[model samples]
Target: MGTFASHRLKNIRTLSNQVSLNGYKEPSQSHPCEKDRISELPDDLIHHILTFLSTREAARTSAQSHWSVNKWTFLECIKLDIDWFHLDREKFCNFVDKLLLSRDNVNSPIDTFQLSSHAIDRASTWLDLAIKLNVKVLKFSEDRRWEPFYLDPNLVVFSSQYLKTLDLSNAVLDAIIFDQLNNACPALENLMLSDCLMEVQQISSSSMKNLNLIGCSFIKDLSICSPNLVSLRIKDQRMGNSSSKNSYLVFGTITLIDASNVEIMELSAIDSMFTFVEQDGSSPMFRNLRSFRLGPWCIDDNFLPLRRFLQHSPMLEMLFLKLSVTTSEPPSTDGETRQERSSTAIGWLRSEASRPLITLWPREKPLPPPPSEATIAAATA
Candidate 1:
């Protein structure tokens, strides 16, 4: 076996040198003593080394020898960032197709598959292939230049029992896709949905441990029932253009039916009408919560809800209050002036004396001294 492996490796090195002439420059001929020691390694060891290289680098190296083609098949991770393809959509698709086709006979599982592309018409096929390969960590997104891509969530046939993490950005999702995720991906632990269009009314999962929903504008209500969830973050709007209208209305309430296991939670840009619902009346909502962050939009003129939320979290240790300047002034009303509202909010902040409070505000505005016992900080961004 040792002799056979050595001979195979030698043949691969010779082929690699010939293939390298296609695009990459060939190295100057050297004495046999100065030849690459890497080429002398066993096939398995060479494949292990190739796995550390980027997809582009691996492809370039594989072109140098016909034997190196087998090394690419042993790769467990594939990341095709199409930006490097120079926006050649057809060429990118063809390359991916050929790569997968070549590995059609290989039964090795793909540990990670991340693809960022502008051409998403064939995304379903690629996802199907990844599922067939038993992908564990899957991240799919369209290029930043285009609007959010609409994907048929049902198209994701998650036959892979090994799937643990899923991240989808700038995509459209409906109730069916959420249902499929809950039923198909039993091993899913972490899920991140960012800047996407959501048509689902409820997002429930039993196996999920961490859930992040950021800049999802279309979700009207969140009904999470992940009993294993330890961390949760929900942000209603994106940073830029706060005035931009969404296709669908923002969530009015977040129903934590079975989220008593959650330990850390963050809420940002939540409208005043939004509230929390605990299905179980016997237990307090967020009993395990230790860290809580309330974004600027989460607190409007009213501080009662914010105060009530903090009061429920008895074991809370770290508290973050992100305050932002509203671009437009509130319309004059006979009920209460802006100054009064600000004063009332400040009074509520002073009342939370038990926890360590960290106040975060924009950098453009001068940082005021710490309020009484609270710590004043600026936004890291």
Candidate 2:
């Protein structure tokens, strides 16, 4: 086992050497002083290269190689990708236990700790150690080939006040995660969730500055309430059975309350959350939104929801529309042909682009007083 672990670590120096090649210089007659590019790398990169090594291998390398003495002992990032080395669960667990114990002896604060593995059912102690170490950025992802890791909300309260970034992928999130978010990582500014399973209907955060959601859905119940968020990106793609299209109708509302300071936003494939108008036709506002991106349904009435978004964002300067030429949903253009309706919408968009005023475009189709759900859904569909 130790021999195989050492073999796994043999390539760390090679990888680091590759990264350092840009700085490497062949011995030249003009430049007398030979540059040791590998030694010039920042400690963070060096530590990352060393992450694959077990403690024993790291000690041997430090003793016999050109590495700095005891530098691995002070690594700020603890990234364990057990699957990458073909390490078994028991051996991986034992290695981590010893490594963390040795790290506890050093009592150094961790800047980042990422774990990618399938043996995380007993990962609480590892996470707790990260919190104790005051890790600032933590990324934990489970192997998709195994059972999903259920993230316990109770264990999330990262006692570390310095924790600023948290990324969780391929896990099952509890609804209570939102309830304990503020307390879990009070100073958290960036939160990224990708390919997770959850029924979290609403995600509310006041301190978070950037929030990214990528393909995170099980029942499509998702909303957001973040007043201090500066940048937001959501790429919603259903990750379940392809035969079930009903599960794909998981667009939730964006509780755009107290969100007058958002500067950048991207809503791909799920723009309905932000542009959705209730039966009464009331919609929220984005007073300070400066840049916006949207993914259009590309079917009939798609421009209707877009109209609402432009109307709400008074400060929008850069508008990016990802025009999809194809969509599975049928057109709902009433009697007007797709070409005619598309021409009208495109012309209106052109006219609006030329105008500086944030006013409504000219009424085309006898505009209803309050567009009903059927109407909004048709447009947003």
Candidate 3:
């Protein structure tokens, strides 16, 4: 036994000597991998990879030392959705604060920056940073639980020349902001405002091609002048009957004055009033219009406005009308309503020479049956 033990010790010593001579280290003494190939990637390439991930995920990755400590600042696109924070407002705020702080030294332009959060009041710094970065596409949305988020008008003074597209939701806007946008963002193309509180009376954009306003209220008089606009959509949300004057819902007048170049227009002002003011004595002619959608309110006042509006859209090829039927009445006994609609249709056809394709959609709690053969024949006749 003793002889065997001595022989084993001698063999081990001989093996160690051979390893030293060959300059070969044991696997246990060396790193699992020779080098971190991932970390060795170029900063720009790593930034591109981080752009595909959410802001939270990117921050976590950076914390793990997979990339440079400040590699996230090199990202061209930053999308931070508060939903990922699971209502942890403090954590979300901290993350955003740290992110902007880390990019303080970065002069790189951000291609896109989108942030959706409930606490928009704390996002002024974020917006400032975005503007400073010369962000091209910026979208800021707030939770609709409380009052509309009020944006600081002073921030609008620092107009970003690189801003091309802007989208805001559940915010308060005024004329100053619009004027600033028109002057600052020369390349602005698309603008969208949804569920916003409007304090502005006029929205004039020479460079804008697409404008969308949904559920925006509280303007005594509103006028839109976008000669280069190709698409416009205005929709109003249904509001309850309340005596409170401070309610966000208020009926207002809207005028589309210089939308002659519009190709597609969707107007839904069921609660507010609308008028198409002509440039001169002539009607506001939509020379390039191809698609038009009229909401239930279009049929108000016996569809007079709709008929008159159709006269201007001579090139219109498609028309969509949304009609609401009273569910309180029996579906099979809508004879009066059908007759009234048929007569209105006949009047419209006689007034407008263009024979555009018309589609009617009925909306209510209970779905109404399709028009009977007789009803269709009568309408066609």
Which candidate gets the maximum TM-score versus the true structure? 1
> Which digits, one per residue and each the tens of the lDDT, describe model 3 over residues 1-381?
356445533433433333321123344455476554545667756665665555555555555345555887767788887776676788788777777767766567788889888865677668878888888999998876656777877654438778889998888887778777767778899999888888887778799999988777856688888789998988655444422222577668888888899988888666767787766776457878877777666765566778778868877776767565554533224344533563476467656555676766554322123334464445445
TM-scores for all predictions: 0.79, 0.67, 0.77
In angstroms, give how far residue 299 of model 2 lies from its true place: 7.4
TM-score of 1: 0.79
Residue pairs in candidate 1 whose N, alpha carbon or C atoms collide under 3 angstroms: 15-65, 16-64, 16-65
lDDT of 1: 0.67
lDDT for position 40 in model 2: 56
- Model-by-model lDDT, in order? 0.67, 0.61, 0.69
> Which of candidates 1 and 3 reaches a greater TM-score?
1
lDDT of 2: 0.61
In candidate 2, residue 170 scores what lDDT?
72
Candidate 2 off by > 4 Å: 1-71, 154-156, 218-220, 237-251, 270-272, 275-284, 297-302, 327-329, 333-343, 353-381
Q: What TM-score does candidate 3 get on C-alpha atoms?
A: 0.77
Question: After best superposition, candidate 1 residue 175: deviation in angstroms?
Answer: 1.3
Error of 3 at 355 (Å): 2.4
The sequence of per-residue lDDT tens digits that candidate 1 reaches over residues 212-330 is 88767655565777889999887655455454233454455666666577777777554524466745445667788766766654445476666667767776655666555454546
